[model samples]
Target: MISTAWGISFRAFDIGQLRIFFAFGVLQILNLIFISVFTLYQMLSVHTSLTLLALTPIFFMLLTTKIIMPRMAAFTRQNQEAVGLLTNRVTEAFTNIHVIQTNASERSFQRLIAQENDKVYATDMKVLMLRTLFFPLMSALTGLSQLVVLFYGGSLVVQNKISVGDILAFNIYLSYLAFPLTSIGIILSVYQRSKTALERLDPFFNETPESGSDAKILPFPNPNEVDIQDLHFTYPGSIHPVFMGLNLRIRKGEMLGVCGSVGSGKSTLFQILTRIYEPPVGTTYFEGKDVTTLDPITLRREIAYALQKVHLFSASIADNLSFGLIDRPSEEELARASRSAQILKEIESFPDKWDTQIGEKGLRLSGGQKQRLALARLFLRKPKILLLDDVLSAVDNITEARLIQEFRGIGCTMIINSHRGSVLE
Candidate 1:
């Protein structure tokens, strides 16, 4: 499976195209020497002085490598960054279009997009302009080299050392050399742009995996029980600690209700328990075994966590309900789970029923419908520990009470985090 950073890099750039361009540039460079030697040999055969004309192409390559290529690469990098930023802004605008409309901030968002678009345009123009000037500069140097070859070779003919026909032959070979030289310069320009894309992707390839490949898969005797001793933690980039000397325990088949205010680490607690963020070793344990030593994939198998903010893809009701399931649930199984979550009646009310399409993030559904839909998805999977993080927040008292009844009936060790104190009672 790919990580978050890798996913973002893929969206930001076309990696496959970059590799193709880089390979073409390398192959051209490899063939350049043989082409240069074969063409220049004819000139060297006529007179040794005529071979000095090679300096023109050589000087042009040197200028391209030292000055022109670096500038091209720098601007190419800037252009990529600008384009990526603009893409992010566009995605955000579309995702929150409703919010923008309600706030009457359409012009504000438009201005933001216009500013990013200008940057992308400015950086792209710089790269294109540099490439436009590159070919003409090569031609100018080639023309200058021709003038030198004609004057010196003509001198040889006047002294009767070489025939006039030989001077004509030397100039013809000189013209042949220009094509390969100009081709190599073009290759270098394309190569610089590809090289910049590779640099942007380097960090993703170099990052370390959060879980080790060789981590042990220890079986938990009491997988549903949690025992923490003096747990202390602070989020990254935060000075204040969320938990200090926090000790807690939950027995098997027990339902613990956690009530807290906003930013009080209720969600963070669920994250830590599920190994989303690894807890300190010797502090958190399952069946007396240090959780840090367990494989994250193996450990997460016994836990099913439904987040507060439900995420529904643009898919059918059936697909969203059976998400994360190892095997597709049968029609009967889907109905049972939906019934338990109290969403079956609404789903059945639709003309298409199970096949009905739910728009992105379930935009077609109300807040309570979305929450129950998430619960249905959760009910499809049977884990040893069930973590419901403020799942009943959107529903009314009657709906919440029914869901709580459903939770109690499931008979699993459950930890429910919510702001309502009555949920615990």
Candidate 2:
């Protein structure tokens, strides 16, 4: 039966599915036949009524599959979805754990977790109930079937139409039918689960990122400059506009400062400039070419960013610093870049120096150290434009002054987002 189902499901492709399904099905069938044959031989030459009476449990097992399996599959799918939701909630909480704990939100967190747990538990209980109802009902039905077989077969024996041994052989075939029927539900449930899992992941497999027509090889231009005209943007699902009719021009070798209070759309502006979020339809130009016409990867490669929240890989200090460079830098080059960022002394203090692992997100480093390390990485890349989003906030006044003095001679177009007016002065 499983083979037949597989054949129907994959008929358009080939018989490979059928062959695999049939191979397993045949093995199960052989096992059933062996058990039935052994039982029949033991009961042969015995009274026909006695043999029929012993076959009740087998009939009940067959009846259970017909009634039980569909409910179990539905419950399993529900339970999986509940667990997925719970995991998402836990991840979100951990990402904001600092805020939650600071705000004394332990009760709120507990409530949210409890709600998800309750949903999972309810679905789990439903599955248990289904099993409880199925097993006993199957046993009762099998008992009934055996009683009917005994009464009918006994009459046939008395009339001499069939021998007692023949009746026992026939009962053996009935037993074979019972085992397969009982197991059928479990097989179908597995099929349903596998199908659901595939469907859940189908969108990721089917969808590809949109590509522009002008993505072919183009000549690399020197002295990269950017111009934005009437750029407007609103975040997804946001009611208020982030930027409306914003215009700016950034020329080569010029450093620009974008200062604004919290929620003043500073980061949003940077996202627009980088094309991480597309500006409203108009024109954003890069090196005299329209940004919409340029490949996103090419545009980003020319621009280096050091965000307020720096992310580092779990690798050696050298690997993190040299991440954006096309060719691997020599140890001396890495040391020079680190010194230029004023982080070489600190890195050298570590047990392994440049070869030391930073751990996940550079959690092992202090905020100032992480920012400096990120700056080292940006310097290594040597992009045409550098955008530093509040990168100097964590450093002391003297360190901040030293960084600003060094940045002045870096010879790259820079955009600094900072709250410190003294730095701008």
Candidate 3:
């Protein structure tokens, strides 16, 4: 049941105020620049007394960073990706709890999480090892520089070339070098993580938004009519084509059935028709207007596309049925739609009736009940066009029969797909 749409949750959380969090890193970088300059200038003046020896720590930090940053960044990125996969495993496991319990695959799922957790642990250990070592290594270099100063400067004082006061002042300056030098590792660590977080958020920023939200609003004079021309599509990363130069025209108020085997792009076709996955520009048209030029919000409102999988939010049955409409549907409207989907009888059987709670994705209901509930939601919309992808597959033959009988009363354009030819009939 996973989809490309899962990435949208990552997008929603990463936008808005989170964009400004990176600014703190910018200020930190500026501070780093100021200190590095002042510290180097004083140290260079001292380096004149003993050339190359006083410059040892500066060279050490640069050389160590060259060895460490790339490895640190690589480990950090792997850790991030591991965490995401672990999260996905957890989500999918929870969502598919019913199937897992039914098949007694609880241990299998437990093992799955254990395997993913180990991957995350392995990557985390690599990052921790680098972080733990980096600061100490920098501190050692700074101490080495101090030893160089004491040994060389003490001798100069004995020769009466430099005063004791001069040696003491130089040691005070070296103390300034110690704090900033240690902080560099920490500052660089934060900077590297910030950079990685930004890279992870690119999918959210790069998502293709509704292309025509600002375009001229086109009136759907005949909402039931649709024309698709030269439709060609290929999913990301697959070499084989799904569709190439396809064409179709369906009349207003026509009821049609589509028949195809598995992986035939049947579901994908409905997805494109609803503009869930946008079709290429000029390929899909509704009432003679290109779908790409019409606002997706308005287009989806007219075309009610139901996926094979049914998902219901945790809410009362009445609320789930009336989810998308501008105004709350009336009692009579709710009963009628529920009755049409052959679910009103079941709803009336409950003590709470319409007020009964359905848990996440309607886990409180049976598979057939959840499917009928989804169909009821679609019926409540009275959409101009209906795209059903095996929605009736879950219900028993008797319930399916009742729903099919009620379908004639809808009096709107519909496209249905089912493996069972009897449902199509």
Clash counts for the predictions, in order: 0, 2, 0
Task: Summing lDDT over every window of 10 consecutive residues in candidate 3, give the lowest-scoring window.
Answer: 12-21
CA lDDT of each prediction against the hidden true structure: 0.82, 0.71, 0.80
Candidate 1 TM-score, true structure as reference: 0.91
Q: How many backbone clashes does candidate 2 have?
A: 2
Per-residue lDDT tens digits for candidate 3, residues 1-425, read 33433454344432321343456545655776777678667755654665357657779788999899999999978886777677778878887898999999999999999998999899989988999999899889888878887889788889987777767776777787677777778777777765676777776567656753566667655568888899999887788888899898888888888889898888988988877777998999888888877777878888788889997889999989988888999999999999888888899998999999998778789999999989998888888998899998888888888887777578788888898788889
Which 10 successive residues of model 1 have the least lDDT summed? 1-10
Q: Give per-model TM-scores.
A: 0.91, 0.74, 0.81
Please write out the lDDT profile of model 1 over residues 315-343, one tens digit for every residue: 99999988877799999999999999998
Superposed by TM-score, candidate 2 places the C-alpha of residue 311 at a distance from the truth, in angstroms, of 1.3
Residue 225 shift from truth in candidate 1, angstroms? 0.9
Best by lDDT: 1
Error of 2 at 171 (Å): 3.5
Off by over 4 Å in 1: 1-17, 41-46, 160-172, 211-214, 219-222
Q: What tens-digit string does per-residue lDDT give for candidate 2 at 281-394?
A: 456776777666556777678888888888889999998988877899998888887887888999889999989998887878998898889988877877888888888887
